[model samples]
Every structure is written in structure tokens, then in C-alpha cells.
Target chain A: MSGFIICFLIGLGGSLVYLLRRKKSVKEISLFVTFSLLGFIVWLSIFLGYKVSPDRFFGWIIDSIGL
Target chain B: MENARISGWQFFLLSLNFIVGTAFFVRPGSIIAVSKQDGWIVPLIAGIFAVLIACLWLTLASRNPGLSIVQICTKVAGKYFGGFIALLYIWFFIQLAGWVTRNLGDFMKTILMPRTPISVFHLMFLIVVCYAVIKGVETIARTIEFLAPLVVLIVVVIYLFTLSEWKWERFEPMFQVSTWQLIKDSLPVIGFPYMEAVTLMMLVPYVKSRVKTGLLLGITVATLLISGIVFVTIGVLGVTRTSHFAYPLYIIVQELQIAEFIEHVESTIVIVWLIWIFIKLCISYHCAVTGICQLFRVSDRTWIAIPLVLFISGIAILTHENIVDNIAVDTRYIFQYTSLYGIVLPVLLLFLTWIRRFRKGESGGSA
Candidate 1:
């Protein structure tokens, strides 16, 4: 778990630094950070045992519709 | 955005590799399970259906030259509604990328390297895919153009090497399955690799010319090849075993013992499959990234690519509990879900575009 977090931070940080160095536009930077943070939250939830299966979610929706 | 262009031939190869991608390994078993000895015939029917679907997509693309499906959505539907439609497509593409990535991870874990965590495979493969996508479509096209022939040659050679095991009797119960049952079983096949080829609409504008011919021929050839592979697998492994194994093609290759020394060649063939999967992932990932850029009017695709890699990988891991769960969801829901994008959206856009064009024509005549 610790290893995953460290790797995630390094990857996220490194990418941010690279984008900043390139002087990307504000919108581009925000999009990157937004998606990256979303990814982090997802992975953290999965690792912390708050598993959310897309299959089940979709299946539930599909079932409700009676397909 | 970079004014990238791929030649007609390159587009053809890209289309072939993309459709054949993961389906090459995983689809046959499920297909055989449903259709039994008649499994080989499913791809033929599915191929014809796919060509018709491709026609819808091509006509849509032709109407709006040089515009991708995303741009076309916004153009035809107006801003807010079209933007919503485009957003749905972006989500679809990302979800597709996640599924493809998960397919790779699952295959690696189950067959090749059992000890390695599946996430490692997803991360590593997505990282490489991200790099290729960041390079733009032309690089990907050229790369697949070079690799496509090798994949074809290896697959054909594997087919030939297994010929000694072919049994004529395996096909004896041919055509016993009812037409309704056959069609029923074929829905998933159509929805998959065939209908899923709608993603190629994103690449249609990038092809230099003969987009229709290239797209159709690529799909036709892929269909025949998939049919042929299923045919050969049924012949070698027989209907019973073929339907049973998760990776029947791999099993057939593993059983090959040429001259008692030329054996266990599954590993080498896996390298070829990896190429197929890589090309497929690159195209989907590219389409997803490109869709986001065009939809949001973002300046740079490069920055978006890296972050998406993280999000897609998360979805890959979070999508299913395991292979069984994955297969269950696929058989049950994939057709209905994919049809919304593959069938419903393209048809809807095409209808609206025609209506708009007709109104313009009427106004011009009145003037």
C-alpha cells in the first residue's frame, strides 16, 4: 500500500512539474490535475477496501431498466 | 489538431489490427461456447453485419469531411445538447480503454505471469500506450502498418502447424443449431469487435482517401481471419474442448509439438498478440484523448494523456471482480450498452445531419 502511494505521488508530481515546465495553459493544467486527483481518489478507495465495481453499478442500472 | 494524416493502406492495417485486438484471444471461446460446432459461421454473419454498420459510420463521416465523430456531434446537434452527446462518447471511449487494459492485465495474470499483480500489467501497458498516443496518430499508424503483417503471418503459420490435428467429424453436427439460436448467440459477437469498430469513426477523417474502401476491406479481412481462426480452432480442439477452455487458441498453440523439439511456442505467439493489443489500446486511448481535447477546446493533448493514463488504469482495476465477473457482465450487458454508441448515436447523428441538409436545400431553392 505504501509503495503504491509513493509511486503514485512521484508519478503525479513528476507529471505536474513537466507540464509546468512546458508552461501549459491554465485550463490544461487544471484538467490534468483534476483527472489525476480523481484517479488518486479512486485508487485510494480501492486499496482502502471501499471497492466500487463498475460492472455491478452498470448491472444495477441495467437491471433497474429491466434489460 | 497537428494536421496528422495516414495513407489509405496504413488506415486499413490500423483498422484490421484494432478490431482483431483482444478479440483474437478472448472472443473465440465464448463464441464457441454459444454456437458450438457452428461457431466458425458466427464471424461470417457478424462480418456482414459489421460491414453494414461500417456503412452507416462511413456515410456519417463522408457528410462531414475531416470532422471526427465528436466534432460532428457538436456541429449537427448544436452546442449544449451536442456537447452532452460528445461527453457521453468521451466517457465511452475512456471506459473502453479501461476494459481493454483490464483484458490485457487479466490475460497476463492468468496465463503468462501468475505471480505479478494485475495492476502492474495495467500500469505498464497503459504507460506505453500513453506514450504512443501522445506521439499522435500518424506514428501509431506507421507502427501498426509495420506490425500488422507480422501478426497475420504468425497467426496463419500457427493455423497451418495445427492442421495435423484437424478432425473432419467435429463438424458433423453442422447446422443443427436453429437459426434463431444462432442469431441470438451472435448478438454479443456483433456488439463486440464488429459494432465496437464504431470507434474507428474517430479515425475516419485522418485517412487520406478511399476511407470507405479501406475501412470495409479491413473489416472484411478481419472478419474472415477471425472466422478462419475459429474454424481452425474447432477443427483442432473439436467443439467440446474448444467451447470449454478460456483461451482455446492458446491451448491449441501450446499443444503443438513439431518434430518433438519445436514445442511450447505459445510464448512467442503471445508476443504477437501483445502487438495486436498494443495497437488496439493505442487507437482507443488516442481517440479518447482526442475526443477530450476537441470537446473541451483544450490546447494540448500531451498534458491530458498522462492524467488519463492514471484514471483509465484505475477504471481498469475497478471494473470487475475477476475474469468470471467480467465475462458475465460482457455476455449480459455489453451488446445493449455498446449499441447506444455504435448503432443509436451514429444513426441519430446521420438522421439529424440529413434533416439539416434538407432544410438548407429547401431554403436555398425558395431564395
Candidate 2:
């Protein structure tokens, strides 16, 4: 778990630094940060044994529609 | 957006690779499982429907030249509604990228490196794909154009090498499946590689010319090749065993023992499939990134590419529990899910365009 966090932080920090150095627009940087953070949360949840399967969610939707 | 213009030949290869995609490895078993001995016919049926769907997409695209499906959505449906529609497509493309990524990870873990974590495969592959996508579509078009012939050559070679195992008797109990059954079973096939070719709509405007001929030929040739692969698979592995294995083509290659020295070549074949899947993922990832850029009016795809790759890897890991669950969801829900983008939306857009054109003609006539 510690290893995973360190690796995630490295990736996040590396990309953030790269984007900053390039002087991207605010909207672009924010969008990147938002997506990166969302990705972090998702992987963290999975690491913590809390997987939210999209296939099941989709299956439920299909069942509800009687397809 | 990057002023990238691919030639008609590159467009043809792109369409062909996109349709074949991961379907080459993952889809055949399910198709065979459903259609039984006559499974080879499913691609033909699905290809016919796919051509019809492609017609809808082409007509819509030709009428509004140089505009991608995303731009067309915003143009035809007005800003608010069209933006919403475009958003749905972006999600679809992302979801598809997730699936393709997961498929690669699953295949790698199950077959090649059982000890390594599936996440490793997913992350590594996505990072490479992200790089290609960031480089722009011309890079991708050129890369695939170079790789496409090698893929074809390898497939043809595999077909040739496996001919010694072919048996005509395997097809003896043919046409036993009723036409209705064949069509019904082919729905998932259509929804999959065929309808999924709607992703090519994202690339149609990139081609310099001959969009119609190139697109149709790509679909036609891919369909024929895939049908031939399934036909050969059924002949070699027979219906019962072919339907059972998860990667039947892999199994066929594994069993290929020419002169007793040319053996265990499945690993080499896996490399070829890796190229195919890479091209497929790149196109979907490209479309998703492009869609986001166009929809949001974002100028640079570079910043967005890395972030989206991370999100896609997360979705890939979260999408399914295992291969069985993956296949089950696909068989049950994929057709209906994809039809919204592939069939319903294109038809609706074409109809609306016709209606608007007619109204304009009427006003002009009155004037």
C-alpha cells in the first residue's frame, strides 16, 4: 500500500510539474488535476478492497430497462 | 485539430485495424458459442448490418464534410442538446478504451505472466498509447499504416501454416442453424466489432479522399478475414472445442508444430495481437481525447492525454471481476448499449439533416 501511494505521488507530481513547466492554460491544468485526482481516488479505493464494478452497474441498468 | 491529414490508404488500414481490434482474440469464442458450427456465418450477417450502419454514418458525414461525429452532433442538434449527445459519445469512447485495456490485461495475466499483477499490464500499455495519442493522429495513422500489413501478413501466414489440420467434415452439419437464429445470435457480433466501427466516424474527416470506398473496403475485407479466421478455427478446433476456449486462436497457434521444431509460436502471435490491440486502443483513445477537445474547445490535447490515461486505467481495472463476468456482460448488454451510438443517434441525425434540408428547399422554392 505504501509503495502504491509513493508511485502514485511520483506519477502525479511528475505530470503536474511537466504541465506547469509547459505553462498550460488554467482550464487545461485544472482538468488534468481533476482527472488525475479522480484516478487516484479510484485506484486507492480498489487498493482498499472497495471495487466499484461498472459492469455490474451497467448490468443493473440493462435489467431495469428489461433488455 | 492538429492539421493532420492521412491518405485514403492509411484510412483504410485504420478502419480495418479498428474493426478487427481485440475482437480477433476475445470475440470469436462467444460468437462461436452462440452460432455453434455455423459460427463463421455470423460475421457475414453482422458485416451486412455493419455496412448499413456505415452507410448511415457516411451519408451523415459526407453531407457535413470535414466534420467529425462530435462536431456534427453539435451542428445538427443545436448547442445544448448536441453537447449532451457529444458528451455521451465521449463516455462511450472512454468506456470502450477501458474495455480494450482490460481485455489486454486479462489476456496477458491469464496466458503469459500469471505472476505479475494485471494492473502492471494495464498501466504500461496505457502509458504507451497515451504517448502515441499525444503525438497526434498523423503519427498514429503512419504508425498503423506501417504495422497493418505486418498484421495481415502474420494472419495469412497463420492461416497457411494451420491448413494441414483443416478438416472438411467439421462443416458437414452446416446450415443447420436457421436464418433467424443466425441473425439473432449475430446481434452481439454486430454490436461489437461492427457497430463499434462507428469509432471510425471519428477518423473519416482525417482521410484526404475516397472516404466511401476506403471505409467500405475496410469493413468488407475485415469481415472477410474475420469470417475466414472463424471458419479456419472451426475447421481446425471443431465447434465444440473452439466454443470452449477463451482464446481459441491462441490455442490454434499453440498447437502449430511444423516439422516438430517450429513449435510453441503462440508467443510470437501474441506480439502480433498486441500490435492489433495497440492500434485499436490508440484509435479509441484518440477519438476520446479528440472528442473532449472539440466538445470543450480545448486547444491542446497533450495535457488532457496523460490525465485521461490515468482515468482510463482506473476504469479498466474496475470494469469487471473476471473474464467470465466480462464475457457475460458483453453477450447480454453490449448490443443494446452500443446501438444507441451506432444505430439510434446516426439515424436520428441523418433524419434531422434531411428534414432541415427539405425545409430550406421549400423556402427557396417559395422565394
* TM-score (all chains, Cα) for each model: 0.96, 0.95
lDDT of 2 by residue, B132-205 (tens): 99998999999998887788788888999999999999887888999999999989888888888888899887
Q: Which pairs clash in model 1? A: none
TM-score of chain B of each: 0.98, 0.97
lDDT of each: 0.88, 0.89
Candidate 1 ranges with C-alpha deviation above 4 Å: A1-14, B365-367
Worst 10 residues of 1 chain B by lDDT: B178-187
Best by TM-score: 1
Is model 1 an incorrect, acceptable, medium or high docking prediction?
medium
Clashing pairs in 2: none
